[model samples]
Target: MEILGLACAAVLLFGAVLSIETRISRSDRQLARVERKLDLLLEHMGLQEHDPRLREVIELLRNGKKLYAIKRYRELTGAGLKEAKEAVERLG
Candidate 1:
């Protein structure tokens, strides 16, 4: 009976965690949608600006320092390694 009680408690805790995770996932989606709309609005208003660090990345790439440029891009943009690599490739 005691073991069963502990198992039930564990199940309840798991369910609570799942519920929180679902809410967080939904919130993240909503935030992403809002950010996209804001970006579009800024673009429409001619207020969207490019990141200045992009120039530094370009310079690094031009100097044949591709690895350094990718690392710098990731740092400046908070992008993952693969995304940074792709972006650097695009710039190159």
Candidate 2:
């Protein structure tokens, strides 16, 4: 019947979608692992990536305005407040 056929089609479509999503989830996990390894490698090499705009944050930090430094870092990097504050602390 047409109803049965439509049900089968819907089930196939849903299975396809689930398969694609599972593949994507697996890929994401793999990418995260690779990135973590790369971060560790970079840390072991004692090399840090430099951003020119970090200078502005450093200046604000040196001026004793910690909150302003965090705000500037967040603005420059589009980072969250906690991340920006941690970065400012590391830089100082």
Candidate 3:
């Protein structure tokens, strides 16, 4: 009986952890979807590809010129400008 109770407890704990992980993953996917939608909207508004300034900023970020990239992005996108700048600084 003791072993059975322990096994049941372990199973419940595992299930709870699995549920939380699944929820987190679902939320992450939803957030990604929203981000893609925003990216598309920005594209439609001509904020991507052709915008030399933004393109340059992204290039700098990709090349690890994070600080400069964030500064330029802040000056351009104005999306979470301060946080984005701080994130780049942290990344660097």
Candidate 4:
């Protein structure tokens, strides 16, 4: 009877540990997702890294003034449309 009780207690302890670990992992994932979303929002708002030149470029793109074409962006900033699009996407 004592042995059976010890085994049951051990099983309960193991289950509790597993449950806590799962909850912790889920919390970590949620925190990571929130951080990524904040980064994207800041970038879209042209607030990322606080570069005034980037803000000017973003403004030009927002006004449809065409500061640079896709190819030109690659030439100038070594970034593609994916990077350039982030600047203007928030304005719209």
Task: State the displacement of the C-alpha of residue 50, model 4, in Å, after optimal TM-score superposition.
Answer: 7.8
What global local distance difference test value does model 4 have? 0.65
- For model 4, how does the per-residue alpha-carbon lDDT over 1-89 read when each residue is reduced to its tens digit? 99999999999999999999999999967876786688788878878455444555655566676645343444556544665555345
| Model 4 residue pairs with clashes | none
Residue 43, model 1: Cα distance from true site in angstroms: 0.7
Give candidate 2's TM-score.
0.59
lDDT of each: 0.85, 0.83, 0.72, 0.65
Q: How do all the candidates rank in terms of lDDT, highest first?
A: 1, 2, 3, 4
Cα TM-score per model: 0.61, 0.59, 0.53, 0.52
Which scores better on TM-score, 2 or 4? 2
Mind giving the per-residue lDDT tens digits that candidate 1 earns over 10-79?
9999999999999999996787678668767876887744678799999999999999999999999887
Residue 32, candidate 2: Cα error in Å is 0.4
RMSD, every candidate, angstroms: 4.1, 4.8, 9.0, 10.9
lDDT of 1: 0.85
Q: How many backbone clashes does candidate 1 have?
A: 0
The order by descending TM-score is 1, 2, 3, 4
Which whole-number lDDT from 0 to 100 does residue 60 have in model 1? 98
Runs in model 3 deviating more than 4 A are 48-92
Model 1: per-residue Cα lDDT at residue 70: 99
Query: Each candidate: how many clashes?
Result: 0, 0, 0, 0
Who wins the lDDT comparison?
1
